[model samples]
Target: MDKNELDKRIADLQAERERLTGELDKARTEARDAMIAGQKPGGTAAALAERLSIVDDALAELQDRTRSAADSAERNNRKRRAESALEATSKRSKLAAAVDEALNALASSWDAYADALRKDVGQVSGAGGDLTAVERALTNNRAAEPLVKALIQSGGVKLARTFGIDTPIRERHAISLADAENRVAESLRVELLRVKAESPQPNVSREAQAELEKMETAR
Candidate 1:
């Protein structure tokens, strides 16, 4: 059957399963109460026992159906994922090749980059224009970081903005470690809200759509 039909069937079975489970519990309680009252077999006690058996059988059947439906849904999802991955393989390979070429080109200009760094920072007496020393100086100069990044971006045109094969570098607002920690804390709150929305709750304290008005008021 189609996805919508399968989903509806699963949901109906789940609700019935829950109902059967509750009925079974009630039957057991009734049987216990009858026995405590010194009731004999083949009457109220026997009726309750029989009802419990029927409920258990129905619950088991529903459980099997639920599992089969869930497995079918999972298989459909897996097939879709496999198809998407196969489609993207060619793009991924091209991006990988571009990245390798960029690295090789950058490697050839290492000495020239070090010389430029020395010129920008001004040479020290003992450094003696040594390539390693110049490279170290460039690495240690925090001011040169932005310039180096710009150079890499310029040389790697395939990796630039709007290249859909992979994510391109972009400027982002700098935040402190404390700000990052606070963002993670907020993410936890968002996750809690998502879980509450998705979980099936027979009873709820408040309607989520109504509570959403609080967010608007805060804004």
Candidate 2:
């Protein structure tokens, strides 16, 4: 049965229990009066005992019904909670996955743009700040333009003419774009897990609360 129905039934049963208790008390009073007035009292005593038994049995049955209704309510609540958790998980998973796809696309596009930019500027500083700005532009809109316009705006794209086309810059190997992309990957992984873990519903098991302990020191 539903919670409201169960609650009404419990309230009705409680009222019945109260009525039974009152009847039991009245019966005891009647039996005592019979004994005080010099009547045999045997009949009243016998009836009182029986009424007591009836009240006890009725109370036991009501207690059982109360417990059963409580158990049912708990089961229903659990079913709803599980369904909600599943729905939340699905939504969060999709959001995190979308984030992953978007970042990956940005990285790929940025890598291509960086390659072109590098060639045009003859392997300019492989600074993460430059690529980061480009990556942001890929996601947003870039204020920087190309050739004449860009050159006029940002001074100009200057190259180290001392380095030959075949030679490396300052005798140091060019850093792969993958290195910066790795940093992005690490950042994404943490954010993805955070997205998955952040929930209004309790993720911790009820039983686990007992076993949890405060750490004395870092491992």
- Summarize candidate 2's per-residue lDDT along 1-219 as a digit string, tens digits: 555765676577567667766776777778788879986554654665576577567657766776887898799999999999999999999999997997698569756775665553322222212334224223334332221122223332232221112222231322334544454454444444444445344553322332232111311
lDDT digits (tens) for residues 1-219 of candidate 1: 555665676576566657656766676677678778997423544565565566566657656766787898899999999989988997899998998897787566655755755674433323222232223326653433333334334544343333332333333422222343344444444445545555577233244433444544765
TM-score of each: 0.30, 0.44
Error of 1 at 194 (Å): 80
> In candidate 1, where is summed lDDT lowest over 10 consecutive residues?
125-134
TM-score of 1: 0.30
Error of 2 at 87 (Å): 1.3
Backbone clash numbers for all candidates listed: 0, 0
Segments in model 2 whose C-alpha atoms lie over 4 Å from true places: 1-39, 121-219
Best by lDDT: 1
